[model samples]
Target: MKEYKLSGWPELPASYQRTAYQRMLHQMSQGFVPLGQLLRVSGLGRDAVRRFLAYLQASGVLVEREHAQTPRTLLVMDWIRRTLGGTGPRRQA
Candidate 1:
């Protein structure tokens, strides 16, 4: 993995963003994110997530994986909910 130097807090919410980034990182560490799943997890629109994902990829925070039938993001989501102390699994319906 490449090293990325994240600069200054800059009055932006670094802590808040970092939490989400860490969750994403944890997911990637466990497996990999399938295309389009970041939007749902990050609560960001598709365009924004596309840009964020690109930035993460470039920054070495994330990597793109080969396409697959089942998205590993589902497992990540469950892990996140568990980590956050949420009750029950998140429902897609």
Candidate 2:
């Protein structure tokens, strides 16, 4: 099988391209890194990350839960994760 490499980055929707979304995905994959650390890992501006997270919430891809005084984003990656059943139906617009 030919090994396929991505050309640049995936052209995600504007909602997904937000820094916050990027940071959230990165943290979910890499595990609980601090904001500063996430910034270093994501290579995006602080403000941009904030906006990305907002988009993720709006898209219903993530949910926020309050703990004490702070809110933490809960990953809903399972919506995309394959299950024991057959492949899920595509989302409708």
For model 2, the local distance difference test gives: 0.48
User: All models: lDDT?
Assistant: 0.52, 0.48
Q: Which segments of candidate 1 are over 4 A away from where they belong?
A: 1-19, 70-93
Residue-level lDDT of model 1, residues 1-93, one tens digit each, is: 122222321222354366555554444555656545554556656666556555665555454545543367768767787779876666678
Model 2 residue 71 lDDT?
Answer: 31
* lDDT digits (tens) for residues 1-93 of candidate 2: 111111222336855656655555756443333556545667878797566555544555443432222333222333444343446654669
Show model 2 residue runs off by greater than 4 Å: 1-11, 14-24, 29-33, 65-93
Top-lDDT candidate index? 1
Please give the lDDT score at residue 25 for candidate 2.
Answer: 75
